[model samples]
Structure formats: C-alpha cells, structure tokens
Target: MAGALRAMAGPSAQPPSAIRHPPSAIYNSSRPMQLGTYRLIDRLGTGGMGEVWRAEDTKLLRQCAIKILPANLAADPEWKERFLREARSIASVTHPNIATIYNIEQDGDTLFMAMELVEGEPLTKLIERGPMIPLDAVRVATHVADGLAEAHRKGIAHRDIKPDNIIVSTRYVKVLDFGIAKQIGGTTDANLTQGNMVIGTPHYMSPEQAMGRSVDSRTDMFSLGVVLYEMLSGRKPFTGNAVTETLLNIVMHEPVDIAKAAAGITPALADVVRRCMKKQPDQRYADCDELRTALVKSLKEDPKLARQSRIPTIAVREARRLEPEPPPRSAVSSHPAPQPTPAPAPPARGTRAHRALVADDDPATRYILGSILQRYHIEYDEADNGADAVKLLKNREYSLIFVDLLMPRVDGWGVIDYVRGHRGNVAPRVFVVTGVQNQKLSAADQDVVTALLYKPLDIAKVEQLVQKSA
Candidate 1:
C-alpha cells in the first residue's frame, strides 16, 4: 500500500545525475551547459531549492530562464512531483502581469523549467533602493492584482506572494514563483508533510497560511496585502526575532498600526492594507479584483496622497526582511540600516481621548476597525451607514471620522457632501474610507475631507492619523 501510494504521489522517475548545478557558488557567473539541448550562457541566481540560469534553447534558438532542481533533491520522488506540479500550474496561467512558463522537461534525473526571462530587478531591489512612491506602488500593485485575478480565475492560488516573487520591468510588473501553488481541487491530503512544512517565505505569509490551514485564492490576496503594505510603507506589517516567532505572529497577532509604523502615510493606503491582512479568509477582499478596485479608487481620490505618502524607512526595513539573513558562520558582514521605533505616546484624557467615529455597512470591516481603535485605547463610535454616520457627527464631536464610501442610504461621499454643505464649520477631520472603484471626490468634497482612508483600514495607520489630528 505504501509503495503504491508513493508511486501514485511521486513524479515520473528521471536520472539523478541529470540535475544541474552552477559551476560556482557565486551567482551571475557564465558557464557552459553539460546537459540538455540548451547552452547555459550566464547564471541568474540561486535560491534555497535550485539555481536559475540564463540559457539559449538550441532548438528554439531563444533565450530563457531555466530553473533547475538540485541534484540531491532530484532523486526524491515527492519533491520532483511537487516541482513539476508547480511548473505546470504556473505555465497554465496566461496574463501580461504574470511571468510566463515556456516549457517543462526532465532531462535524466534533473527537472528543468524554461520560463520567460524577465529583464528587470526584483521588487526587493526596488524596495532596497528606497520607499516606492505611492503612485508607483499603486501602479505596480494594480498590475500584480491583475495577474493574481487571472490566476485566481483559473482556480490556482499563488501560495507565495512576496517582494522576492515580484519583478518590475521598465513597462510591466510580473508576479513569479508559483512553486508552491495548488489547484483548488487537488487533494489536500497529498503529501501532508510537505503541505504542512510552511512552504512560504516568512514575513509575507498570511495568518491562514502560517497556521497550516487549507488555503484558497484569499490567501494570495492576504499575501498581496502584505506586499502592498510593504510597497507603500517600505516595511512589512509583521516582524520578529526568529522565523517561528514571525510565523506565530502572522497567525495570532495583529500587525503594528501602519501610521505608527510610518508616520504621514495616508490613512486610505493603510485601510487598503488592513483589509488585505484580515485574519479570516472571508474577511479579506473576495479576491484580487476587489483589491485592485480599491487601489484604483484610492489613486483617483487622492493621487497626491498616494504619490507622496511613501515612507523610506519602511522600504529599507522590507529589504532587510526579505533578504535571507546571513548565517552566523559567514565571514562577510553586512549591516542593515537602523530602524526608528515609534515612541509610545501618553494615554488620552477621558471624554477628550482622541475620538473617532467609524461608518461602514460591512460588519466585518467595522469590527476590525473597532478592534484597532480598542487596541490603541481610543474612544470611538460606530454607525451602520452614511445616514447614521452623519447623525452621529451632528450629535457629538470627534477628533477624526472614518467614512466608508459605499453604504446604503447616503454613502460616504454623500455624507461628506452633506456635512460640508450644511455644517461646513463643524466638520471634524473627515477621512473617507471606501472600497468603491473609480471614485473621484469633487473639489467641494475634497475641501471637506482632511484625508481619504481606503477600505480594509490598517489600524496602525488609523491611530497615526488620529494622533496627528489630535
């Protein structure tokens, strides 16, 4: 029974010596190929599992990025199957924003995948250079979302979405590395050990993924949320001293307030991230389409806020977070830039404690926002919709107000317009947070809103905005 299971689960056998390795440990070295129909021109890089080489396909006479499994691992039946599965799944996805898989072949014992050679820097490199401009982040994230949407449509979950998996070329953003992806209907019980092995890079795994739960397309959305958060703020939403601790936090802890993580980042951008990081899969945006819609709306409502809100410290920290930490035995030394920690502020006074009113039709969004406010010990009130929100504003005063753009009976924009038209002088620091797409606030509406916080609000960012206004 065990042998039958093994055979059924394992990929077709190939010769072990066929697995290819770079000539030297150093990356980007030029070498000639010893096997296959391709000639290796230069080494691209190596990862934990394999080496990627820039090679010429002699038959096709075209350049390709050939990813090869290490020789030792190639003999392992299960690993080979998993690798082939990943390559085939990635090849099935066809999107402009996703890296294309050209072919998959097993030469002897070595499994190789030839994919579109993207001439560009990884998102990690860009983050290392500095915080991405908000507009640039939005643009890149939109493209990523588009790619994810396509993948999700095909019932494939990326499983690993991190800065390292994203490539930014001059004209396009490509999402790569689908080595851990699984089809929706694939057996969850297949290779239980490998499935539970925590197959993703730390710092970017969603709570569900970290906890070893069966993942769906929503998992990719959460990963994208982390990526988007890092792109805009320049730091990951969660961090810790060790991999286990980091994964534990992802599964259990709420992320640091975005505003606290990076001061001056727009609340709207923070909200988008918060929604993406929703712990429960159902709580996140239904898919990448929803996320893309929210990002596009943010770009339209406050292009400047999106453009100028990038915090450099966040990016530097992200670069440090994504790169593999040096082994203790390594002779070389590299020092990451110092990260500035946000000082804890004194508690707010009774009755006057930085007050906020959250208006949203979605119970989950409101609940999450309320939780964030509670964590910061801020006094806040909730309104089910725009009408209640407007009524609450008239009856009492708040230091800040978070208005959801899409709500029944007078939406966020309507409430803002009403408040400005009638109680212009009494308007508090109004922030419109919404998931609505292609929303453009009129000049009059803009005058009344101090800021626009996008939906799926990041709690840390909300706290920062409240403190800034306070």
Candidate 2:
C-alpha cells in the first residue's frame, strides 16, 4: 500500500511554482481592464487556464471572486467561446453548496466571471490536516450530493469534483472551479471539435471519464466516491506515478477494499463507496441522490457495526471547519503615510498561563500530549489512569483535560461520569482524547465533552485546540 501511494504521489504533487503565476504580471499589464465595473484588488490564485482574483465591485460595494482568462487564452476564439459557454452552464445551476456566479463580462483583451467569494479552506487543505472521522465524511459528502442533485435536475454535469475544488467552511460547503463542467445536450459545434483533452484530477477521475467516454451524473458520483474514500482512508483508491498508468488503472482496475485499508471502517460503508466507484456508470448509483441515500444508511448503521470492528491504536482526525479571523489592522498605508495606534496592554502573568491535565495509560501518548502542550506554552499535569486524573482534578483547577478511554483502574468514561456528577457546576471542559476510532459514545455523554481529539495527534492541531479552549 505504501509503495502504491508513493508511486501515485508524484504526478499529483505538482510544484507550487508550476501551478501559480506571478500576480502582478497578470493584472498590472497595460491593457484596458474592467470586469463589469469591478476593479481588481489583487490575484488570489491561479491555475493552468486562468487566474482568480480578489476584486472589489464598485457598483455593489462588495468583494467577489473574479476568474479571468489570460490574454493568450482569450485570444483563441474557439477556447474563448467554450469558456463562456461553461460559465453560462455553471451559472444556470443554483444551490447552496455551489458558488453563485454574479456576472460575466469582457473588457477589451480580458474576459472574466465574477462570483461569490467563499471564506474557507479547500478540502485539499482539510485532508492535509488528517483523515476525517466517518460521520464528518458522511456529512460533507451529503452536502456535496445535495448540490450535485440540483445540477443533475437541471441536466448539468460537473465533470470535475476533486478536493482542490471543494471548500470547507465553518458554516457551509461551497463547490468552486466549474471550469470544465458542462450542461448536457447544450454543446456547440466548437465544443465538439475541441476533443480528446482530458479534464479532472487524475486520481479522482471516473473510469468513463478517464477512458474519454461520454459521461453523465454518475461520473460525478464516482469522483465524489473517490473523494469520500480519500477522506476516510487518507489515501486515494487507485494511483500510480505515471499519468498513463494511473489512467489505465482507473479504466481497467478495481480499487482495494477500503475497510481492509483502514481498520475499524464498517463493511456497509465500504460497500457503499465501492458501489459508487463501480467502473461502469450504470453499475453505480443512478444519481447523486441515490448515492446520498446509501451514504445516509451507512452512517445510520455505523454505530452498530463500530462495536464489532477491531479498534485500531492509530487515531483518525476530524476535518476542521476553519473559521475566518478578522483581518489585522495595518500600521502603514501604500500612500506613504503611517497610522499611529495605541499598543495593547500585556496579559496578566498568571492569567495568561493555562494548565491541562492529561490522563492515559500509554506512556507514549502521555509523553506526546505533554510535548505538544509544552510546545504551545501550556502548563500540563499528567496521570496514568482515570482515578489518578480525578484525584489530580480535585486539587488543581485545569482549563482543559485530555482523557484516554481504556486505562487501568477507572477508565476514561468513568472519570467523565464522576466529574460530571460531582463537579457539575465547576468541572473543566474535557476533551476525550482516544485511539479507539470506532468506539460508540452515548449522545448524552458526547455532549459533556468539549471536543474529541483522536489519537496520533498532530501537534499543530493539538495546539490549535488548546489555543481555542484558552
């Protein structure tokens, strides 16, 4: 499995420099540039065919996401027309999960589309954090399916549905980059001529798409299935170092069983994923809605099946929904003037320090948590068992506590119950830190815990949690 991942990692891991262009060169050129009265602030991101910008709509007084085709691409009348057609098709489908397009405009050499600016990180960033828990994965997939169902209802198909294009925010999921998406039965002669150019990320491409066959809504389902698989398993189902080999696998090979790859994953969940990933579009779920129904069923059965699955020592991380922070105040302006601002007072000495109590029978887990807390400048107390943790809690008031589920003497759940029952009014927020990935917790008990941080903790994520609690 390691060798397979290593082989498939190369092509997908494009160098940052290769994918991004210098922002100034694209927007600051001597060309008559105005995208429907919106002045470009700066380039936000770029891709192979176009550039996305952070722009201010002077007419509307709002910030919007602006995608622009470069002069060279826009000059090609054939590609230019197809691009406009794609924008129109995407604009026609309206859903909460899909980003809304405000307008399409042309100003001399520049052609661009203005849309909503979603404040969130892409799924790619979330995946980089760690593997997501099954429930969270199901939630995200369901939302995406809702959006796709809307599109399919309108006979529109999103040809590309990969991690890089799906945004995860505190309150919503926004699907972005509908560059290659098309409306079924609405293609022009120009589109038909531009043949054989593949679209979509290689690893997530559906078999029909990879084989250059005609596609439908099922194609999107297959790609999303791959995304869900990666979300839960922390790896793509089919992969290879060479593009041809990867494409070949998607066209002819079957993916490894997800349950086998990730222990503790329910068989029902794995089967649902496999069905959606079937090589033949007809063999897969009829549409996004059907696939979503299967996912919902799988989630409902997960709790029962979880008890039977062998628990793994390694922990699965929940994908964080990043919240946007207020922009920092600027000290200087581009107008060559400096603004004077009062310096903030320093924090009170004792008030700034926070203590966290960590309880775990595993010496390694305790050591890891201690090291992470230290790196974040958090004071911590450790106990080997739940009883020891409760004892320590009685004497010292901790801001946060991390408890392991299975330990000598009193277990983690026992400690939680004791604290909740006896110290109801004053108990500190407890974070149930455990390695048992599939353990079922009663909904009532789950509410008392501030949050659950799985084992194999990423120090950065641990610090983030601690900082948030502080």
Rate residue 180 of model 1 by lDDT: 73
**What lDDT is reached at residue 308 by model 1?**
31
Model 1, span 364-449: residue lDDT tens: 45655665455445678999888898888777767667778778788777777766766533456778776544558788887888
lDDT of each: 0.68, 0.70
Span of 10 residues, lowest total lDDT, candidate 1? 9-18
* Poorest 10 consecutive residues by lDDT, candidate 2: 333-342
- lDDT score, residue 149, model 2? 94
Most accurate candidate by TM-score: 2
lDDT for 209 (candidate 1): 65
Model 1, position 265, has a per-residue lDDT of: 53
